[model samples]
Target: MTPPIDHAPTTEARMLEIVFPDHTNHLGTLFGGTALAWMDKAAFIAASRYSRRTVVTARSEQVDFKLPIKQGQLVETIARVVEVGRTSMQVEVELIAEDLLSGDRELCTRGRFVMIALDSRGRPAQVQALPGSAS
Candidate 1:
C-alpha cells in the first residue's frame, strides 16, 4: 500500500523585495550564484527553525532555474523544512518573481538544501525530532 501523504505543518519563511542588481550577473537575468545565495538564506531559516540552533549548508541536491528574474522585479523566496536526520535537515526553497504593478508571480528557481546543525563550538549538534517525524 502506498504511504499516506504527509500533511505536517510546514514552517514557512519569506523574504521580499531583496534586490539584485545587473552588475551581479553575466546574463541579463539574475545570476545563478545570486539564486544560490538566496536559497542558502532561506534554507538557513528553515533549518534553524527545526533545529533551534545554528546550521550550515552541507549540500545542495540540485538547483534548477525554471524562469529568469529581471533586475527590477520584486523577488520573494519561501522555504519549508521537509525532512530531518539526526543532525541534518532538508529544506525546499522556491524563488518567485513578482511584478509590482500587475501582481503577477512566476517561479524563478527551486532546489533542495541539506543543512547540518552546529553547536556553540561549531561541532555537529543533535537536533530534536518533531512529532510524527520519526521514520
Candidate 2:
C-alpha cells in the first residue's frame, strides 16, 4: 500500500556542520563528495523521521553546486519529504553555507533523494497514511 504525503513540517529535518580544512580541498572549497554525503545524511534523517522505520538510500537526483563553501564556514542542510510511495519517500535537501564570522549565508547545493523503508526482514515496508489521507 502507498503512503500519503504528510504536511511538510512533520517530515522535515535540519542539520549543521562546520567546514573544516579536512572537509575542503586544495583550493579551500568544500569537496563535492563531502557535500553529497552531508545532503544524503540529512535526507536519511528526514525520511526515517517520517516513516519511523529503517530507511536506506535508493537513489539521488543530480545535484547542482551553486556556490562554493570555504573553510571556516558553517553549513546547514535542510531536508523534507516531498512525496511518498508504498515504501519509498522523496526528500529534497538544500545546503546553505554561512560565513562563520559574518553570518552571510548562501545556497551552496541542492538535491533530491529517494529512500526506501525496510522491515525487520530488510524488505520494503509500508508507511502510515499521512494526515487527512484515507488509510
Candidate 3:
C-alpha cells in the first residue's frame, strides 16, 4: 500500500547540542560558524522530511546572532518549513540557548534557509506544494 500524504505545512525539525570547548571560540562562546552549521543541518532535516526527497541548501538569509551563547550551555535548534515553491522550500530556523544549571533560555540566533529538492540525476525536482500555494 502507498503511504499517506501530508498536506499540512507544519512540518518541523528540532535538535539539541551542547556547547563544548570545540564548538566555542576563544571568548568561551559558541562560534558563529558552528551555530550556522547546526542551523543549516536543522533546515536540511526539515526540508527533507517535508519533501520526502533529497534536499540541498541553496542559501541562508537574515542570520541574526542576538546573544552570545556561552560555553557549556545547551542549544536548541528548531526548523520549520514556512513556504514551498515549485522545487524549493523556505525553512525558518531558530537557535535557543539555555543555561544548564538555572534552566534559563533565550533565543540567540534566527535565519531562513532555502533548500532545493534534487532528483536522482542531481537535477531540481518538483515537490508537493504547500496548501493554498500556487506552486
| Top lDDT prediction, candidate number | 3
Mark the regions of model 3 whose C-alpha exceeds 4 Å error after superposition: 1-10, 132-135
The TM-score of candidate 3 is 0.90
The lDDT per prediction is: 0.84, 0.92, 0.94
Query: Per-residue CA lDDT of candidate 3, range 1-135, in tens?
Result: 999996544479999999999998899999999999999999999999999999999999999999999999999999999999889999999999999999999999999999999999999999898877665
Residue 52, candidate 3: alpha-carbon lDDT:
90
Compared with the true structure, model 2 gives a TM-score of 0.88
TM-score preference between candidates 1 and 3, better one: 3
**Order of the predicted models by TM-score, top scorer first:** 3, 2, 1
lDDT score for residue 32 of model 1: 81
List TM-score per model, in order.
0.84, 0.88, 0.90
Model 2, span 67-114: residue lDDT tens: 899999999999988888889998999999998778889998999999
